[model samples]
Target chain A: MAYERKIGDTILSVDQISLAFGGVKALSNISFSVNQHEVFAIIGPNGAGKSSMLNCINGFYHPQEGTITFKGNTRRHVRPSEAAREGIARTFQNIALFKGMTTLDNIMTGRNTKMHKNIFWQALRFGPAEKEEMEHREVVERVIDFLEIEAIRKTPVGTLPYGLQKRVELGRALAAEPDLLLLDEPMAGMNLEEKQDMCRFILDVNDEFGTTIVLIEHDMGVVMDISDRVVVLDYGKKLADGTPDEVRSNQAVIDAYLGVAHDDAEE
Target chain B: MFYREAGQFKTSYRADQGILTIVQDRFVIGAFAFVAFCVVPFFINDYWANAILIHVLVYVLAALGLNILTGYCGQVSLGTGGFMAVGAYASYKLITAFPEMNFIVAILMSGGITAAVGVVFGLPSLRIKGFYLAVATLAAQFFLVWVFNKFGWFFNYSPTGMIVSPPREVFGFLVTGPQASPEARYLFCLSFVVVFALAAKNIVRGRVGRSWMAIRDMDIAAELIGIRPLEAKLTAFAVSSFYIGVAGALYFNVWLGSAEPTEAFDINQSFFVLFIIIIGGLGSILGSFLGAAFMVLVPITLKTVMVDGFGFAVGAAKHAEVMLLGTLIILFLIVEPHGLARLWQILKEKLRRWPFPY
Candidate 1:
């Protein structure tokens, strides 16, 4: 709390993005902009294209219509690896930790983009490769300490509980030292305590790293408390985008959540 | 009590990240190396070398290759034997074309050639996965064998379709052809296996290995984390093929002395290496060695027990060997799918705890 976190100019802007799977529209004309060092939340009902929107931003799902401008580079056909190179890293809704690998290794893998020692040197396992690995291992160990999962450092993530797995996934994304972090339901299926822990971690990451977060969460209370701005989507369309107070008072978002009154039913 | 690491501590990440981090492990490996490099050569004879040591080393090299592709990279390849054939034939052509070329260079270049072939076959992996990719590689297996079989050029227009290894030497020691000593042959193959196995271990523990595992575990997430699928899968294929190719080169030049492609490097050869990784423990470097040893030792042990001890006919014993291997593969799959390497790890874990119930 000693150092104030400031929200800066727009770092990512989605302009009229529309995505469809055959006849079904996953997201239609959805547009939003995220400012630097801000927690931007996307909350929507089930099947409201919440994941699809994240997918689009991360280049997993390419929009048929608009362009996504990230760090001033507009792209419609960005590959996920390219997006990652451009400083976008993410955790999946279902924890995507490398199950066979230890937690330490899973987090170390997040530093894949940073490490550049080639296959030949890696085979040698000496000089540059050894130095690179040790340096990255130090960074990964710090991430492990920060996430407070040092106890499970060598444990295979497949055997870990859901809450811990989610935390480890966050640890993996954090290990990348990403500029833009995409977290899909980082606290889903967790108890209140776990949710609180996750909220603290997310806020800490934002404050400590000054990372721009694009989070998709269904928890309204956590969303309103932590997010600088919230976007609501329904039926693959953006309903509202504003500060939590503004969106909370919007009648359209209310109707989208609570069904609208049918006046014709009185007839 | 001996294996306990109660007082030992690592002060640097470099020390901590070493492949043999445990003091006891380094000592054990050092002992094993001493036995392998120094002790084995002294006690070796034609029967031991040809029947067990040479065969096991060759299979270990091949299995390590396949394990890199199938185990570490999570890419199933049935083209291993075919790739090995490419190595054998390439080495044959290289040695014959440039008779003055060093045998080591010839073997390495053969490995390089197989790596290129592996990359070409690996291209389809970018589009397909799992069983479909397996089928694609299976096609490579059949097609490669067919090419070797049909082409007389591979055999250098040999009248009987047999490519024989012309006598080759390294430091005044005959390593290839019929005149090669069993000790020399074993040592030569052993040297390649030791160096390559170490290299394989290093590669699998590094960034390239991490990328391969990342793609294997969850490719979508891997891609999102900046690991390219094309690079990971293809590199797996190339590295795997390189090891297999080197194994093939040794198999021909040092062990067999002469090989017929269709007979030597066939579908059964492919399945043989596959079974090694399955029973040895998939995705483990030690498993590759353990699996290859298990595979090579099992049949030999079965034959010795059945034919030599029980006085069973050699032909019948061979049939029993095949049947027992099938049963063992199934047993390993059902009971401990992680294979012999996992069993070894479990034993080490128990050893560390000793009498403590906890």
Candidate 2:
């Protein structure tokens, strides 16, 4: 199903970002922007500094030279918490769900930002904390319902299937209600059915919530099917930036990311 | 069938969401509270009240503290003895300096002091974890004990180098000192334990608890997810120390009446609380009580059987008791790693499956 994306002003942009460890460059003068309510894809072969670009955006890594502009406000560094506070929530490349916690608790944890009660109230858990928890719990329950993970609400994430664990992680990020959601390989290790489910959810999250998404997915087919725009990274550099069809037809992207043999065979 | 919840469905969120969700669980907790507050105080002899009941209550408080840190928060600290020492000394100071101070105020002040010390000791946790953090916390244990042992001001320069709790009253009832009856002291400690346990349960069931667990599971991810690791770990340390501190205050003021550093807040106290959580079930509030109970009773029972049933010498029986307790703990853990809590859960499950396989 085609999920229409209403393009708006740029929600996030990177300007001439170059990150390196000692002399080895991880990302070199790479720049791309995510427009509001757009499903933006960052696709690259393995070791193409795809994750590094995400790290820079989220403030986990401080680039030697770069400016990150989020909501038209540019800054030298955006700390992860700062980014989260400013409505940038992310899922990890490797599912980082709290393994010991139930799916509900893990999602509720994402509501940490909205919870205003302090230790005094939390310790009592009657007046303020209970009220806040229940209120946030309503939002989390909605996320769980939307994701169709109601059955695993009480189950620990450690025991869940890999695909479900990924979904729970997504739920956790969504529970935060960020304006821009960063999903790093959200459906990395999943069967075709699971991937389809994840794809539909991602599209629905974008379409229904009108959330701008920055997605890093290796699967070109899924990326092309869902993302409104594609940014191809190769050798720590921006290779191509356009719509999926334009990126698909780019010779450099086909050779560096899609493989020359595959492209020729397809042609 | 009696254990089954087939007809006890929750009709409200409050009913469904609580420390005791099942109706049977609520009943069990209610019954236990009644037995503790009303029945035990009336029936227990001085020996049971002073030597056993009060001691168990105090240890339960301490174990609850340690479990929150090591069990739930995943920040291991071998500083229970040290933190408790902070509480003991702080309470002693508060009691001695302000003779007009209420016992409750002194205990709370001591908890605050210990929380400060705990936060200081906990700072390194942000930079380190696992055994290294454990080893670093041991420094706090050794240093705190040494501070109390070496400093005359701590004990008020008493020739015996021990601090004695002055007599204090709560609501026209003697709660501390030699004049206090066993029941007075027992009730005092019991009240504190019950309150602390409730607060602990409440905290762990809510936002603070989730943040601590998130940091425990994955600190990096927790940070990215907006949980401040520094805040979470330090809060764990502060809160854990606060409870342990109150236990120390009770241990000195109500139970022992006088505390010598080596004899009172030693490394053994730390290991004992660690064993409590291991035997009770880590990350479960009910485990703290069960573990403390198991630890307190098993030793006394072993000693009684060794001395009476076997005609062993008192010293030999003491040694034999320790060995037997050790053996039992090992066997119990080997059989069910989640401890007595898991055992109780298993029993409940079996009861639910009465007359049929589940």
Candidate 3:
């Protein structure tokens, strides 16, 4: 609410990232930056190293040569956990929700960084631990409401339908109150209704939380509708980067999309 | 319709997050504790106390430990007996080394020491999981027993090569050694069961517990979600070992009073606790208690029936008991791999949805 629909200074920058797996370059000299309170989408075919770029941003993969800067903190070697603590949260393309746990528990786990109770307090489960848990429970409950997944709050995520599971995964990432939310195919495998719901939640999160978002999606209409800036990747190289219309109309992106003529989706 | 929470309303987050939210569940738990604390101590004699209750309680604590690691964290440890031995030896050394040490402090220190050792053995878990991790824990079990057996210092150089729990008083009540009364010893061990059980309940209800469960379900996802695997796994090992350590100390100080390492904490003992978790239920605190009871009672019942009710020899009855127990454990695994806990849960769920035909 503080900055309504405003995309500010760069919150995250990836410079000269080149990730290779033993002589195979997965990404070659890739670079991109996402602004504050903006929805940035990375688009490419399956092997465009799009997911690899997101991984490098979150410190899951240390690119052979590059620096990832987040919230004014830049580093080459930082743990994924450190990235999380620094308020960078992410979801997986494959829906990495803790399967056996309840939806509420899965989201509350995302609040682990905010919970500071030590083992002694936790062992007692009174005083600070109880108070801390109550505080976070409210937050998680709100997330459940926002995602409209109140019915599955107590059900194990493994037992839920795929679309609801993806919603729960987003609920988990959002529970972190992250500065930059990286969603790897948040709408993957979703039908039209689910995709619409996910798009709404993503827009709501960016607007209400004033959170920066970097997501990778295969759906063209969803991407053009939501993403403020689009990064097109092809064979581990940054092909084009601009607003939705600019990238959509670019010849290279058109050719890269392989003449499917997705530029019409912007209409 | 019988098991309903219809009238019980929780308006606050605190009430909503209770260990047992339902009014009937709390009432049942309260009644159980009341009987254990007030009623059973008065009616129990030496035969019942030593033969069943104390053994069950100590194993309850140890089972809780293994359950936390293997059940909650999904680490699948087979070294509970070894960790318990570490606790027993540590307590012996602490008490014998300093006679003036308070029994409670001595017990806690023993658990702390065992926790340290547990963390060491838990390192292999980072590199391996499932059966291989279990084998690593088994190695820990053997190595700890060997250390206690080979070293004279653990046994205080006694010719028997065994450590004996010296007489110790808690609040002027003799609770250890030969001179202690069954009621006092039983009460002391029960106190441990009550306190640690509460602590375990609390731990499992909080963030630490969630992290363990998260790690159990999926380690990579857990790590990405900011649940540190090293911290979560090691803490599970340390805390679980602490519970098992206290159980071991109580086993030595209050239950057995003295014991040789090899006989006391063997691979069979490890299997015994493992069976308790498997039979009782993995990842259910209630399962550990159910497991301990099932583990302790049925065999004693079998042995007694074979030897006393029938005309079988004591040794023959023991063999028959072992065979019967093996069969029962297999039957339990086949019937409900989640253990009695899941069965109990199914019953409760059915009860909640009662008055309607299936």
Candidate 4:
């Protein structure tokens, strides 16, 4: 590993977060901090509220009680679009690619935040609008090349395979050039080879672009292999937070995953 | 062999991103424009100009407008007739009030006024979508026609309750009212269609179009990716209405010359435009033109074939034409739900891979 990236101060920190829907609690009092340029993984069982946490960070969900601090700004109710403008991007658990659009267009949409030309100028498609579009197309082409999906660039995303769709989803998120990338189960259903490719791409993105990654994955092998730090959640509460080795060694995390003494654990 | 792009490599993104990227496509468009502007007017008699071509061109604009909202942005609007009425009446008032104003300026201003009204009607789109939004726009259609019918100010308090285009001239050429030559009216409508259609094509391929499509495909993801649903939906409404408004102005002034609100901007007109997009193709600029032509030509073709060729009575032929058009529309929807544009695309793909489709 010749990558020599330095870990910097905290880029995103969640404090005293509690999310509930009427009677049921989704995430309660969960707290974690992610360092800049580091790969952070959140791992838990099916009902651990991992996706809800990502939604809150990206402003899709408003936590009943919490403050999310990103870069230096602190806010409680940031909008999804506003969060994207603040350099936060995410991919959904289920591939959310625009079914009617080509792979290239889907990726180009990630550059929406970067584009500023209004509808009037767009209608003319000359001068500023043309220049802006071409410039962004170049960036999007780079993402397509990096993901090695040039063959399917013109194909509608709905026509692509599951693994390819996931990769395209990643390409779309990358085209935004965000500082913080939240990936929900990027390798949930991948084969060994596909998983290896995704891991390499994720590591390379972290190294080349210095993007701070906060991902949720269920695979223990991937979490331990790539993540600099890991957090464990169970039933909407934080159980452990430390470097991979420490979290792995923690007895509570082991009991939570192995399901030992379930009756005693509830109390 | 002619349609393939095998050897036409685009060396730059600018060239690749052109509205007409293929040489053959560009040549085809150029040829069509030449035929339309140079050759057609010389041969266009009163019968063809007044009965068919101008009507097709005007509806093409309206179809393009509705397509922007329903096809591209996925906001189903049934208020097209109302929006067009706004344009027609607005232009009538502008033309009558400022008799010195150019018709082009009046038409453009009419489009602006309709865009504002469209945005107001489009506010409900943010909270509703799909068939629900369709219902909301349906309400707009009825409300607008009712207002125009109820209020005399819209029709300028005419004793006959009809709004008429005053005779207008551009550079000494009559363009409006009874004195305007059919050729002049044809050319006038032709110019607007050409420019606005090109502009529509440009808008749909750029960033604005992508945002609208994004919002259409999956709004939540679109919002998460930084597209404001408010801006995307409203802009779609505004742009769509602008085109419809221009079409409305042309429909009233150039095509009809005089129109009563109830008779002219009724619910059927809205459905007529909706059918154009449905049969032509949703979200396709070419589809708008194809759909409009299909809509306008079918009736004339039926009349010519039934009333003239087969010697059927005119009244019987008219009834048969309506039944046949309904059946054709249903058959088209069944055969290719994506519309004529998709069929055109499939044909091109096959042609490109000719000799062996594999």
Candidate 5:
């Protein structure tokens, strides 16, 4: 599968990105762009390189070929910390909240990059260090309130229900105030009500913060309902890229989902 | 009603994230500080001060160091005594070489020397974890002590491999040798412990501290969140060793006024410090102090009661004292796995809800 399109003022441009694990090619020459403030959904079957793409974007997996240019900056070797410092935040497919820490502390950990104070001031518990801590806490609290998780502020994240733990993971990413947010299956394993709440929060984050969201979602219904643009992939290659209606109507996509039309029916 | 944060609203983040937000906490800490610095010094004579205060201060430093590695960073270390030996021997060698160097600088420099040794031993930590890492550090415990003992140069080639204290003075007052007054030695150890303990508190609360806690809670998650584990782990080792080394230096210089390789840094010292943290609380500054005091006081209290208060023979009392300490460690572990710190938290919790059982 292959695709080509011009996005509106691209915020991230991936040109010929490829990756391999041992002798197997996980992603082969994949390319795409995510524009500012758009809900760009990457939909694909299992083993279609969706997670590999996300790993590349967040600097967890360094691509063997091509460039990842974010806001006009290109780098071959990027660390997760560098990506975070450059205003990219992400949640894992498997939730990775700090188990021993409170939900509030977990979110506050996301603000690690934004915090500026050193050890001296923290020891004294005075001056600039105290002021910086307070400022970060203010932002973290607002995120907690925004997600309506005030009741579990001091609860250790490990003990929370799966849905709430996922919410906490999202709140942590939000606490970073990233320019681009990559969410890998944000509604995975969630019931209908929890899914609905998460969808609303995702939209609100985009609308309120003007954040660009690149999400990998398995639920086609939710993807079709929320995505401004969709990119389809099959077996590590792009199958289709267009608006939801165009991708839904594409012959290849229809055949992939519904199988090829019978000659007898055509006769 | 008094202990609750219910009506004390925090409109600002500063107030919300403070170490002590409740008014009662502030008052309590203030009172504790007052007793430690002002009241205790007045009542104790020179002998008691030298015997108790100096020992307590030395343990406090060692405990603080162990807390950084095991408590804050979540790296279990069993080589604390080895690092202390490095400091003790290094200080001994440094003073012997440069007899005119200031005693404080020599002691602190010995801590720096121990930090270097700690980093070398700490390298194995990257490839292992938990009990494996603990065993890896045990290698440092045996190897370093053996090297110090084997090298006669550390003890100035003394026949018995023991380093006797050279004269040490502060502002022209003798403070380290046998002739030095116990008061001067007690005051010296006290001042050093106070300064470094405060410094340790600061390091743990800042970026370094948060990074350590992050690593402790979850290393993979911490790395994904942008904390480099190697840097954090190494820093914990270096700082932790620095504290342990200083404690070792003081142990020899101030308290014993003479040191042997077998005694200064040994397996028992490692277990002793580790027990203090376990019995006090892991990952807490106050817990380190409480734990150190508890460990030091328990055996002495037992000995005094058995031998002095009652009329038990000295040898029998000593045996019973050891048994009692072992029993207390087991009891503390079973009843409160979080150590004395958790007990402190429970007491505070109850005080907060005064006149209400719940």
Candidate 6:
């Protein structure tokens, strides 16, 4: 089947992306697109190259054969910093907040790509540099307030509870002011209450900023509940892509998750 | 209640984002600055000023440099002395080649030279990290020291493989060679240390600093967040080596008045600086200064007590001093892996809630 895709409406267009390490191919010609301001979810079984897709999109990994076009910038080879500069921000599969630094400082680091002051200005820490820092601080403080981590602003992130640490990581990604946000398992290891809270924040972030969200999630319920569109993958290949309901009914998607039938049907 | 920030409203973002939002921290920092720059100089005698304060100042600068690499960036380097030797020898050559050039310019030029060399050694960090990277830097230490000792030109072609200091002056006042007063040297070293320390703090708290911390905390994550590991890591090396080189120049031109490659750029200097950072606090600017002071003062105090005061033999006292230093290092690591800096932080926290132990 063939379908027409809108140009400007698509925030990220990945065409025939493949990545291989030595003898084993981690991802084989995976292709997908996320629409602007839409909540897109990539769901697959373990080792289905879900994280690898996000990594390639964010420039952590360069695909051997593919084109990743984001916000009008097309590149065969793109660096992570360049991806970030092009308004792409991502949280890690594992929490990666600077352990030795405070939550506020960790969030502040997210503003680093935007900070323009030189070394001399920073050293003096007065005039334009101080003004810039204050502006960044205000943004970071707003994030802290939004996440309800105000009390732990000065506390080192390493000492924080897992849920709060995840919140802090979200705040950091927000600090980048990204057009497309890649969140990898934001509610991976959380209680029901924490999961609900994170879901609310994610919805708020999407609604308030109109940021395009791409996420890799294991929880089918959460994925179906929040996602506007879903892409299912199996064995380093795209199994199906459409509205959540459309993918939910697709036989290939079901087969990927429930396993292929053996000998027609079970007795 | 007095430390509360309830009534101190921030009318602007500038007011809200200050390093010290509370009045108490501002007052303390102000008082501490006054003591360091004004009060301490009056009480410090010529001998202590020359031998102790000057030494402390020099080590402080070097520690700040090493702290940028090992502390802020999380790239554990064991080659501080080698970088420092590059500075000292570079400075020696600069002065010898251009005898009439300003002494300050020569020292800074030496720093530039060291930065170049540091970036060269730092290239290996792109592919290696942690223990393996540390070993790579150790190679820089051994290789550089060998070059300096083997090449006569580094020492101004001196027959004995040592560069004797030439008489140098700053704005009419003699500041180099043996004739320079300790007060002059102290002021000189103090000014550079203060400027560079402030610079280091700014860099660490700014964009470059964030990139470094990001790389240190998680390289994969940092890349995803838009920081190039190569750019950040190399910048750290260049900046760190620049400061270390300046400290080395001062160590030779001002402190020693004569420099040998082995003495100026030896591996022991690297250990000494590394120990200062470890015992003070890794990744802390204040910790660097505190660590340097502790490293410098403890041995002098031990020597005084064991030899001069108690009349022990010189050799015996020296041995005791080394043993004591080793024991203190182990003790500090065991008691607080973060070092004396964490101890100071704990004390401050305790005092913040004083007269009522929660």
By TM-score, the best candidate is: 4
Kindly report the docking quality category of candidate 2: medium
Task: Give the fraction of reference interface contacts each candidate recovers.
Answer: 0.89, 0.72, 0.72, 0.86, 0.54, 0.81
Q: Which stretches of candidate 1 lie over 4 Å from their true place?
A: A1-3, A263-267
Which candidate's DockQ is highest?
4
TM-score of each model, in listed order = 0.98, 0.97, 0.96, 0.98, 0.88, 0.93
Candidate order by DockQ, decreasing, is 4, 1, 2, 3, 6, 5
**Candidate 3, A4-82: lDDT as tens digits:** 4777999999989899989778999888888999899999987889998888888789888988888888888778888
Q: DockQ of candidates 1 onward, in order?
A: 0.87, 0.76, 0.72, 0.89, 0.47, 0.67
Second chain alone, TM-score for each candidate: 0.98, 0.98, 0.97, 0.98, 0.94, 0.94
The per-model lDDT (C-alpha) reads 0.92, 0.89, 0.90, 0.93, 0.85, 0.87
Order of all candidates by lDDT, from best down to worst? 4, 1, 3, 2, 6, 5
**Rank order by TM-score, top first?**
4, 1, 2, 3, 6, 5
Candidate 6, A1-267: lDDT as tens digits: 022222239878999999887776878888888889888999999888899888888888888998988887777688888888789998877898888778888888889888888777887887888888888888888888888989998798899999999999999999999999999999999999999999999888888778889998999999999888999877688889999999999998887788766733211
User: Model 2, range A99-144, lDDT digits (tens) per residue?
Assistant: 9999999998999877878888988888878888888888998999
Highest lDDT: give the candidate number.
4
Interface root-mean-square deviation for each candidate?
A: 0.7, 0.9, 1.0, 0.6, 2.1, 1.6
For model 3, how does the per-residue alpha-carbon lDDT over B1-358 read when each residue is reduced to its tens digit? 9788888988898988788899889899999989988999889888898989999999999999999999899998889889999999999999999999999999999999999999999999989999999999999999999999998988989998989999999999999999999889888888888888889989987899999999998888788778788999999999999999999999988999999999999998899999898899988899999999999999999988888899799999888898999998888788888899999989988898898855
lDDT string for model 5 (B97-116, tens) is 99999999999999999999
